[model samples]
Target chain A: MNYIFHFGDMWNARGEFVEGALMTLRLSGLAMVASLVIAILGALARTSGPKPLRMLVAAYVEIIRNTPFLVQIFIIFFGLPTVGLRLDANEGALIALILNGSAYTIEIVRAGIENISQGQIEGALALGLHRLQTFRLVVLPQALRIIVPPLGSQFILLMLNSSVCSAISADELTSAALDVQGRTFRAFEAFIVAAAIYFALSLLFSTAFATIERLAFGKRISR
Target chain B: MRSFNAGDVVYLLLAARWTVLLSLIAFAGGGLVGLIIALMRVAQARAARWFAIGFIRVFQGTPLLLQLFLVFFGGDLIGVPLGAWLSVILGLSLNAGAFLGEIWRGSIQAVPNGQIEAARALGLHYGQRMLRVVAPQALRTAIPPTVGFLVNLIKSTSLAAIIGFVELTRAGQQLNNATFRPFLIFGLVASVYFVMCWPLTIAASRLERRLALAYKR
Candidate 1:
């Protein structure tokens, strides 16, 4: 077991890894924001809409929740290319993450929405507010408050799950580590660095989400 | 060109055996380790509690894929070289243990404080109370979520493909590469996972419902 330690390679390739980390952060941030918006709409559609819309949302949640994220990635990346719908690896990964995140988000958001008392909606309607406006001004605010802690955790999970993009050679942190591992034949060192970087990124993302939460709902909750 | 054949299906099913085996190993190994973690988390010592928290935070906070990478390659980098099978088991078990521990700790703490006080007043020691009183109740409460986590642990084993473990996902990757039938191959892969997970999901839900009913009564 002649082990040669070289911390220098990782330092030498720091720029590439930093670039990859930034890309991962960017992709995850955008996907999280997009999925949250979509989930808010989907949750509403599922709970209060027509039967057909409810069925559609239910099917969406069930299918995605039951399947593996890797298979979903393969469908978008490899399956789409055969139909002349090629996307680069990053785009494919982002699309997959966004789609996957939306289903779980819908479920979480729906839980929060259900926590809102039914009387609140009726009261808003009685006050002359329209259905959409009542949902916007009354239901969603309360739901979002109940859902914030879980929502923060979900965002953290998304940030971490973004590491899966390495499968498609998405030059993200894990892929960068793999590239360096291949070049240096230092698989252990490369992976340790990659794992630490991922942990650090997760911590950073959660802190940022907490800050955003304070800004977004701090006033409402206090008042 | 080899058309969609029965042989391919047989091969894929054969590969699924490893997936099932890996899941069992992970669950069995993780369950034991998780119990220890759970107990330690509820231990009176401050250091033990903090250590459990740190373990959960580190493992739960990072991607399983990265941990798999560390386990797979970290073994190679160090003197102790291991096969992918061993590394995958070790890595998945560690991650599963941390999460299961946290979940079980929540259940343990959820038990009424009065119950513990009653046990203590009856001259039962800490170990006696935990073994005879606290754990039995927590076990019933923890079953459903524990089962749910087991299902998730199984699905997550697919991430082992990145390290070339040749489980279901890797087998699907190999078939897809050869047949250029990503749609069929990966679709099959997902269906297999769905079949594997759906039963556990249903059972967990039923278990939770039963537990809720029992509590109400």
Candidate 2:
């Protein structure tokens, strides 16, 4: 088998690839932060709010979780324009990412919250800690620790799923690869390079999350 | 503007049929290949184990979207004869096999060592012990996660639309191009997918509980 060594072309395109990687990082980072906030609130509401509110939040989680993120992006980017809620492709894609990420996050956070022992809640109440304060100070911290690894994996998955934004013309890493490949007509080489870049990014983000988990939870070796 | 049409709805429903067919093909094909990989990883030979591990690592390390593009374009480059249906099925099955293999390996290991030892002491051969003693219990543990992954596989099939597969999402895109009614078209698309996936999700949870209760009893 012969190989085309196009180091010159790949070098010239390095700047474009870097720019696309930055955009991918920005998109994934913003989506992760936004979904973290939404998920906390959604999880809390689902666990403790009134019946109607709980049901509404549950519905939101189930609907988003069950549908494909690609379909959601299509709806927001392409479908929303018909309903007079037009947004540009990037905005639409970001919204869809946050919405989809939050659904999975809600489940993760709720599981964490539920893992807090009832005895701890009783201890807090007996000590006269307010309900909200107990949750904020005690239960949440422990729960977050329990949920950290899975949550990290979820964010990595989110970064990979962010490739769907390319389908809506968001011009991130995958889209940039598409453009370069079209211009060069070296589709195989372009995709191989692109897939390697994505795999590297995933490893980078996973390491970053592991560091963050260490910082947040401190080193308490349970095992 | 064209008025809302029942005919469009009928077309979307028909497209959903392809989505179901693609999911079945991927799941069945993936399951068979995954079984081989799982057994290979479980084999006493280190070379077989390492080869299966490397295969799973390469596929699992990459995203499904990239795999789809590689298969679609690589088919063109190599002069492989395949339509959208065959290409998507081949790509998704390979991806699913890697993941499901790892999942089953973990589940199989979760079965205690004593059970296998006891099976051997009872004069069972290695193959007989695995088939009669180990596999049945691992399969029970595997069912829930396997079902969850299958639901995910179904959703992932929507990516095939990018390569011109006329599944549910692609059909919605076609209708939207014609009617210029993105909201109605994609809303219908998302709902159809939700309807297809939600049952599996529920079934997975229920089976998980049942398995847990069965072992407890």
Candidate 3:
């Protein structure tokens, strides 16, 4: 048990670590926005669109949900080039994250939407709201309230999933740790530092989500 | 360079057996550990409960990739040297246990307090109450989420590839490197996973419906 722990290498590589963490944030943030958009559209399609469109969305969700994210990244990063749609590692990673994230998001949002009572939509229609207005004004706000907590957790999960992007050589935190470990041969210390940084990031994001929840739904619920 | 062939597909399909094996190991190990964790979470002792909470938090907070990396390499650094197979199983089991423990804890709590009181009035002891009354009902509630987590666990066994365990994903990488046909190779890889996981998803939903019928008012 005479293992010598070293943090000096990690300290010297702080710049790379910071850059990597920021890349993780950026990648997750961008994918978060993209996936939310896709999820909302996919959920809406599943809920009220034509039968064919709903089936299409359902199939997409099923396929994505059933497969591994690493394989999805590999397919996009490598497979897309064969069709003349070449993308860099970062772009490929972001697309994979969004594709995977949105499928779960669609299910969550659909559940939220379904949770709204039938009377609410009928009441909105009786109040002279059009179908679009009824959905926008009456249904969405309530669904968002029900959806926020799980959605926040999913976003955190997305942040963690971003680590898988390292498989394709994305310059994110996990890849940076791997690079450091290769250079310093301090795999243990390198990953420990990366794990600690990830823990901090999770805490930070959870607090931020709590604040957002308060600001977004606090007053409405309190009333 | 060789083009993709039937041999490559056979290589992948054969390699997928390792993926299935790793998943089974994770599920069995995780389920055993998770039951302990779930019980600890519900234990009256403050220390046991806090330890359970800390375990869930640490595992859930960090990436499974890092956990796998740590176990695979850290074991060597400490001279224990769990090779790729043992390391992958250990890492995936720990992660899955944390998630399953939490899911089961929720299901256990969801069981009606009235049922517990009824068991108490019948003069049942703690073990008898949990085993005969509570656990059966909690199990019904636990099945859907537990199966769902198992599906996710199967997909995650692919991560074992990073530590040089040549499962489905790693086998695909090898074939892709040699053939240089990513589309055909990776697409075949994904379909193999889909074939494996889609049945589990369907089974979970069927079980959910059966449980719903059993509980219907």
Clash pairs (backbone) in predicted model 3: none
Q: In candidate 2, which residue ranges exceed 4 Å CA deviation?
A: A1-8, A211-223
Which of the predicted structures, 1 or 3, would earn the higher DockQ when compared with the native? 3
Q: TM-score for each prediction?
A: 0.94, 0.94, 0.95
**Per-candidate TM-score, first chain only?**
0.90, 0.92, 0.94
- Which of 2 and 3 is ahead in DockQ? 3
How much is A177 displaced in model 2, in angstroms? 1.1
lDDT of 1 by residue, A108-127 (tens): 99999998888998899999
Give lDDT tens digits, candidate 2, residues A1-223: 3444465666677777788878888888899999999998999899989999999999999999889988899878886777678698789879999999999999999998998989999999999999999988889788978777788788878888888788988868888788888888777767777788888877777677778877777783231
Estimate, for each residue in B110-213, the C-alpha lDDT of model 1 and write its tens digit: 79999999999999999999989998989999999999897788789888887789888999998888788889989999889988988898899899999999
- Runs with alpha carbons beyond 4 Å of true place in candidate 3: A219-223, B117-124, B213-216
- Predictions in order: lDDT: 0.87, 0.86, 0.92
What lDDT would candidate 2 get against the real structure? Answer: 0.86
Q: For model 3, what is the C-alpha lDDT against the true structure?
A: 0.92
**Alpha-carbon error at A32 in model 2, in Å?**
0.5
- Residue A116 of model 2, lDDT score: 93
- In terms of TM-score, the best-performing candidate is 3
Give me the candidate number with maximum lDDT: 3
- Number of residue pairs clashing in candidate 1, backbone atoms closer than 3 angstroms, sequence gap of 3 or more or interchain: 0
Tens digits of lDDT, candidate 3, A37-140? 99999998999899999999999999998899999999999989888997999999999999999999999999999989999999999999999999889898
